[model samples]
Target: MRWGVLGASAAISRRVMPAIAAGGPTTLAAVAGRPQSAARTTEVAAAYGARAHHDYGALLADPAIEAVYIALPNSEHVGWTLRALDAGKHVLVEKPMALSEADAVRVQEAADAARRTVMEAFMYRFHPQQRRAADLLASGEIGDLRVVRASFAFLMGAAPGDIRLAPGLGGGATWDVGCYAVDAAMLHFGRAPRAVRAVLSRRPGADVDTSGTVLLDFGEGRSAVLDHSMDYGPRSWMELQGTHGSITIRNAWAGADEDGTLTVLGYAGTREESVPAADHYRLQVLALTDAARAGTPAPIPLSDSLRTVRVLEAVFASAADDGAAVPVAEEGTG
Candidate 1:
């Protein structure tokens, strides 16, 4: 598969682009960046041996590019994804596919209309450790799952112009890091939440949240507790507690050369397993490329993206209401 990148962001230059070059049966054909960053874009493209286009449309128009990785900011995800689909190119967009459920549905409709594959770039989902954990849950090694606790946080420097702290750019602790916890919970429970209640903390004069805690009720005594922050010490992990035992995953989201661990405790005994280090980004690229070639559904379908966004919407609403519980709207409805 031949690929084009829509931005010259750090993630693109340092991770996905390199993954494309080394990932199986894929080529880094082109890259596009804003006109103001033409030099940086050219430098990035040259490093990867790909053509550079200052305008995103020019890269999309390239006949040799079969798919595109949209690394633009959260606000630009939906628009660029729709444009890429319209250009007859498959899309693998960054996480939080949309800031809202409506935009996610729009992207889904456009992808279906274009008969193109579209996937959210939740690279961690492609990691082998995730699969192992899922298998353990499926095998009933942890009886019936009753609760999930997940958190992802890191300190953000007091930079005045960081995009993650900009409201207009869809920046917030929940949107930036909380989505991973929400996604992990949903992945384990295999269903969307029924309701959500959240509380957020914002620094003085800041319009966006710097930290938040959310409770998702999945009904029937099943639930997830999630918390995220941009002003906390680094921590990332998820634990699933069940009737019989529990499973804890350390560093749940593995990056390049980062190995994770899974510990399962039950009536039988406590066992710890080491997950081999792997580049999930490379795995993600290969998976999407293979799916595109086979003309099959995306590895991470748009519907899943919609559910995640719906839950996020409920979280934000609840926070705005002073932590009052908010019901998550059903799919295809308001």
Candidate 2:
């Protein structure tokens, strides 16, 4: 598959693109950006051996580009995803697929009608380390699942006008990083959350959250706590506790830099596993190719997205109600 890029944020340009370049059955074909960003994208494309264009339409209209990676701001995900599907190009959009669930569904419906792929890029799930964790959890080494706790945060010491603080841009820790925690918890539990409660910190003039903590209950007496922030030190980790022992994975969410540790303790014994660095984007691209060519399922399916969006919506409702607990229902799909 020949791929094009829709704008290059620091994260996308430096981290994701390199992984895409190394992925199987996929090649970087072109890059599109704002008119003013054309020059930078051009230089990047040249360095990566891809074409470059000034507007989104030009890239979408490019015949050589069979797929496009939407690395634009969060708010642009829905619009561009729908447009890319309509233009006959597969899309792998950055996560928190859209600002709202309705928009996410619209993207999915467009993809279904076109028979094209519209995927949410949650890179951690593609990493081998994540798969290892999943295997360990499924083996019941941690015994019957009970609770999951995860956190992702980093200093946003951003420039005065950085979009991470712009609500209009769909910028916030909840949409930015909390999605990962939520995804992990939901997938690990293999069910949608039953209730959600959250506290979002916001300041005047800032339309997005600076930081927040959310709680998810999956019933069966199981629950999870998720913490996210845009104005804090770097932290990414998770833990799962069961009836017998516990499994702790330090830096669980930061799969790209798998310089983390995994600990499993039980009546049998205790083991510490050192996870080496892995290219999550390469894994993601490979999975996408598998789904497209072999008719394999997406690593993160549309229904999983629906439940996640539902959880996020409930979180918003809870936050809007000043942290009132909100109930979440089971979804028809994972």
Candidate 3:
């Protein structure tokens, strides 16, 4: 499979693009963006020896591009993902996949009808440390699943007119960073929470949340807590606690080094440990390629992402009601 990038988003140009360049099954083919930004896109693509286009549609229309990565702002996710899928291109879109559940459903429906793969790019899930964390839980390192606490946050800093603070760009800690925390909790628990509640701090007159706390109740049996912030300081931390032992993942969001020598706080000892894979993004690309080639569902199903949206929506709703707990969707999320 040959992959094309929809825009020269920093994440792609830096972390994600380098991993794809590290040589998995597929090759980077081309990158595209608005003409005003294509110069930078072209520069990055040239560094990788790939073609560059000024028009995004033209890039998608290119017959050689089998798969494409959509790294646009959060608000543009649904439209571009659907467009790419409709153009007969498989997609790896940045999370959260859409601004609303309806948009996510539309994107997934388009993919289903086209028999194309559309994966939400929660790249952290592809890391071997995450799998290792899961393994630790399964191996009874943590006696019985009790509580999972994860946080992914950092100060976006004061960038005047930045999209992160603008409501129209789908900017906010909730969609920007909170989604990762939610994704981590859901993935660790391996199911939607039984109930969710949130507390959000909003900038005056801004329609977006800057920082928030999400409390997820798995059931009478388990619970997960996640916190996200766009202001404060730099931090990426996670811990899983149970009856026996616990697991700690420092720098969980950004991923570890190639050998997966991430600082793991566990029974193995609190030191850097080597995981199987080298690069998280490469693993994600490889998974996407295999899923697209096999005509099967993504490793993380689209419905799972939709369910997350429902959870976020419920969080906001609950917050609106002064943090009253709200149940996750019971059924019908196609």
Q: What are the TM-scores, per candidate, against the unseen true structure?
A: 0.98, 0.95, 0.92
lDDT of each: 0.91, 0.83, 0.82
Q: Is candidate 2 or candidate 3 better by lDDT?
A: 2
lDDT of 1 by residue, 183-223 (tens): 99998998888899999999777789999999999999999
Write out the backbone clash pairs for model 2: 304-334
Report the Cα lDDT for residue 200, model 1. 91
By TM-score, the better pick of 1 and 3 is 1
Clashes of each: 0, 1, 0
lDDT of 3 by residue, 218-265 (tens): 997788888888876587888888776677776676553534434545
Candidate ranking (lDDT, best to worst): 1, 2, 3
Residue 309, candidate 2: alpha-carbon lDDT: 86
Q: Which regions of candidate 2 are displaced past 4 Å?
A: 203-205, 255-257, 332-334
lDDT of candidate 2 at residue 181, scale 0 to 100:
91
| Deviation from native of the Cα of residue 239 in model 2, angstroms | 0.1
Stretches of model 3 off by over 4 angstroms after superposition: 203-207, 256-277
